[model samples]
Target chain A: MTPEELAEFRRRQKSRNWVLGGLLVFFAVLFYAITIVRMGD
Target chain B: MTTAAPITKQALPTDWRDFYALTKPRVMSLVIFTGLCGLLAAPGSINPVLGFTAILCIALGAGGAGALNQWLESDLDAGMKRTQKRPIPAGRMDPTNARDFGIALSVLSVCLMGIAIGWLAASILLVSILYYAIIYTMWLKPRTPQNIVIGGAAGAFPPMIGWVAVTGDITLMPVLLFAIIFMWTPPHFWALALFIKSDYAKVGIPMMPVVRGQASTRRQIMVYSVLLVPIAAAPWFIGGTGAIYGIISIALSLAFLALSVPVATRISEDGDAMKPEKRLFAFSILYLFALFAALVVDRVAAYQGFAL
Candidate 1:
């Protein structure tokens, strides 16, 4: 990869990683909420 | 000079937005709205947390189905102006990744729904996913002009699943909700199809306008539009919803049919814009949103001892 291509790739990778991390955290919270609701019912 | 050819078919790495695009978020919003309406309008109630989970599952399943549809129809999408900018067709993402992403979301949504809500809702969600991804996308869409008529059932499932999420079983009201959408879909989709007939023809998808000619397609749109009015009014007729929902649905359905008048009668000249079809298409979205919102409002009124 050229310098520009390499830089673009790095930017894309960083964004994808951050999004994936955010999604995982959201899912964890969701599951916890689901568990509490189920237990209460 | 010897130089290595680039191995990547994609011009750049796929962004998260590309993946989101595969979900067809605009359509997902409708699914989410209708599903929430069904949940809220049901006779009983649910915890807000559980209710949100059901809607989230419906949205995810819908997104999964949209992704799989794009993955399979990437070639067809590439041929059309409306869909050419999609992730796979635009070469922003790989088809394999899109397919796998769809499967993951599909599995996760169904499993979460079953564990979190109830198995009945989850099973319906599973069926809806399959109905869209495999039955509609893989089979009906390319094969017949009647594809939208049958495949529209896939979109109709969300509200019924939402109803079942609270009720935990099937009933006439949910079935009526499914039927209202099923009958409403042809006219709604055909209006859009009438305007974008060339896109279907270029891709050889056998849309009604391309197969039956524009006049026939318009007539069919009128027929479905007439049929939709009665079906839309049925929930009120059956005493499922109050006069509020009934009154709004009838008014909306009549307006929907009225917009079809010019579309049914007019012939398109070379330079003329298809304004009637476009207007009807725009109204169809609003009509559904308004109809479902009325249903929820009516339910609330009934719960509060005010609705007639």
Candidate 2:
């Protein structure tokens, strides 16, 4: 494979990782929010 | 190394992930969260184990409705970029399979809820699933612009169902919760429609913006936004919530109105200045979270004798 193809693949992989990371952060925050409300219950 | 030949297949592949996707987990999360708030707000106590089962059933019912919606709209979904990657449209699941799966879940969830919770909560869950899957998805969506307005009732039922789960009776507080969600839906959805207007138009879905135009939709959003303030504060006024919730409701309402007013006033010629619509859309999620969080906090604070 050409170096250009390798570079493009790496970039796509990085973008996917960022998307997954953002989703994880969102879920973590949501869980924390639920915990805070549940604290009193 | 030799390049492998592409495999040809007649039918789409399926997996657990695809089945999960059919349920629309993202939408169900919000439904479950709001229902939990309702359960927490009610006056009576429920068995913890039973309550958990009730919530799980509610989530499954919501998921069932969503799967049925996707199955019905699979064709239209393929035509729209936003929904083109959904399981059905992406060739990961067959429409008939999704239809059967949704119906099965719908029955299972309602039956389990009836046995574990009460018939009242279970019946409401059954109606909610039916309302969304059949009334909204099959009947209203393709036919009219007012679909979401009437269809919002399905989403509004969770709190009532939750309240019933705890108390086994309907009351003003749960109805107030229902009304809050009912009134909030249009503005919340219209804000999203503003950004995705073209998609609805392309599919002939007759969303408010597509039918009445962007300007009219913006006006309607502002109207609903203003209306939501009083409705949100009703619980506080009626003593279901306390002063802290009252203050939070007012503040959040103001923030929502502040965001929506600009969208209402912006001229279409000023292209994209209606970005406030999108801002309001994002804030709407936070607005709901804050209002419900305030309710839980006030209840806790009062229980602790921190208030008059």
Candidate 3:
């Protein structure tokens, strides 16, 4: 592949990784909240 | 000017935006809003964290259904002017990838809802995913003109599921909420179909306007609008909500019916802008959002002991 095409592919992959990472963190925090709330109930 | 060339999947790098586009975020917003109103309007209370989780699940499930729909109809989408720019048809993503992504979202949302909320709500969520993905997209849409009328039930479930998430069971109020959307869908969708009937006809999809003719679709829109007003007002009449919701419901519905008057009665000619049809289509969305927002406002008033 050309260098420019490879760079574009890397950029896309990096962005997807960021989104996936952010989602994972959000899910972890959400589960922590859910657990605490259910315990109090 | 850009060359008019064919797009192929291999030529494009899949981006997060394309993946996001597959979810039909605009429609998902409405589903999320209605689901939230149902949760807020239900008689009981839930933990704020749990409530957010329920809404998230509803939203994700909607996204999943939308992706699956696009996956299934990629070819049909390619044939139409409106849907040709979707991820699959635009060659930004593969159809199977969208399908797999849809299934993953669907399963994860249902499982999370069941674990965090309850199995009852989760069960309904599962049914909704199936209803939209299978029943509406695969079965009804290609086969019949009455597809959206029946398929509207799938969209109607979010509010019901939201209520059930809090109350853990179904009741008349939630059912009434369900009925309101169900009755509203025919006119809402048919108005859109009336204007875009050519796109549907090009793809051989049996939209009401294409299959039953524009005049028949117009009459049906009027008939459904008349039916919708009473249903929208039923919650107040049944004492499930206050006069605030009732007053707004009746007023908005009357306006909806008024707008439908022009759309239902008038026949369009070639090159007609279809302004009345477009107006009703736009107002129908606002009407639903306002209606549901009114329900939540009524609920809040009751909670504060200010019965209006």
Candidate 4:
């Protein structure tokens, strides 16, 4: 691949990884909230 | 720095969208809907967050199994026009990648379900993934005409798992829900197979219409459709559901039987159409959705202290 194309691919992959990481964090918070509620109850 | 030669582009490249498609989103939607209905229809209440987690796990588990099924059947899929464009079959993604992604998702979902909900729901989730990936995909699908009949159990587990997520115990109501979907699968799938018989025959997949001929397949579809009426009404009869659910079940089931009759009895000549099969196939999806939606409505009505 050309250098420009390789750079574009890497940029896309990085963005995708960020989205996935964000999802993971969101679910983690969800579970933590659930645990807190259960303990409080 | 000394410069090296530019690298050549690969023949095919896979993207995130290809990975997403491996999950078979359309099928996952139905699974999620049914699982949500099961969770809602259960006798007790669950934390909304926990309930969401349970449904998410069901979706992931279903998607994982779907990916694994696609991975295992890539070669077979390549031979069928309908499936030829799937990730693995299309050569856009490696089979190993699909397999590993599926296994990772399966394990992750099961573990999350155990942690967020309870082990019972998690265990059932695991069993469902195994049932679809190993039992149905690996063993049954290529072997017998009765593949869908038996393998339908895998798809039927989601609601039961969802119910257990809330109740933490197996009960007659959830089992009835399971049986409804289980019995609904054969007719639903066979209708599609009747229209696409050549696809299965070309790939040697041993689908009902391919192996038993269309006449016999249609007859069995009718038989299952007839049997489904009573089974669909069982929850209402047992007082597990309300009159609303009961009335809707009876109405939709009769409509299902009505649709099945022409498909069962009609003999197609040269240049004949597949209108009956197509209509039945489409109605079957709506039938399950409407029936399950009625269950949720009935539960909500009873909870609100309305006479149901």
Q: Pick the lDDT winner.
A: 3
Off by over 4 Å in 4: B1-13
lDDT of each: 0.91, 0.82, 0.92, 0.90
TM-score, per-candidate, Cα-based: 0.96, 0.84, 0.97, 0.94
Clashing pairs in 3: none
Model 1: lDDT of residue B242: 93
Residue B298, model 1: lDDT of 93
- Candidate 2: residue B70 Cα off by (Å): 0.5
Question: Residue pairs in steric clash, candidate 4?
Answer: A1-B7
**After TM-score superposition, what is the CA distance of residue B220 in candidate 4 from its true location, in Å?**
0.2
Candidates 1 onward: DockQ, in order: 0.85, 0.04, 0.72, 0.44
lDDT of 1: 0.91
lDDT by residue (B138-227, candidate 1, tens digit) is 999999999999999999999999999999999999999999899889989999998888889998999999998888988988998999
Candidate 1 vs candidate 3: the lDDT winner is 3
What digit string (tens of lDDT, one per residue) describes model 4 on residues B54-107?
A: 999999999999999998998888888899888877776777789998998899
Q: How would you order the candidates by lDDT, starting with the best?
A: 3, 1, 4, 2
lDDT (10s digit) by residue, model 3, range B173-227:
8889999999999999999998888999998999998888889999999999999
Cα displacement (Å) at residue B28, model 2: 1.1
Interface RMSD of each: 1.0, 9.6, 1.6, 3.0
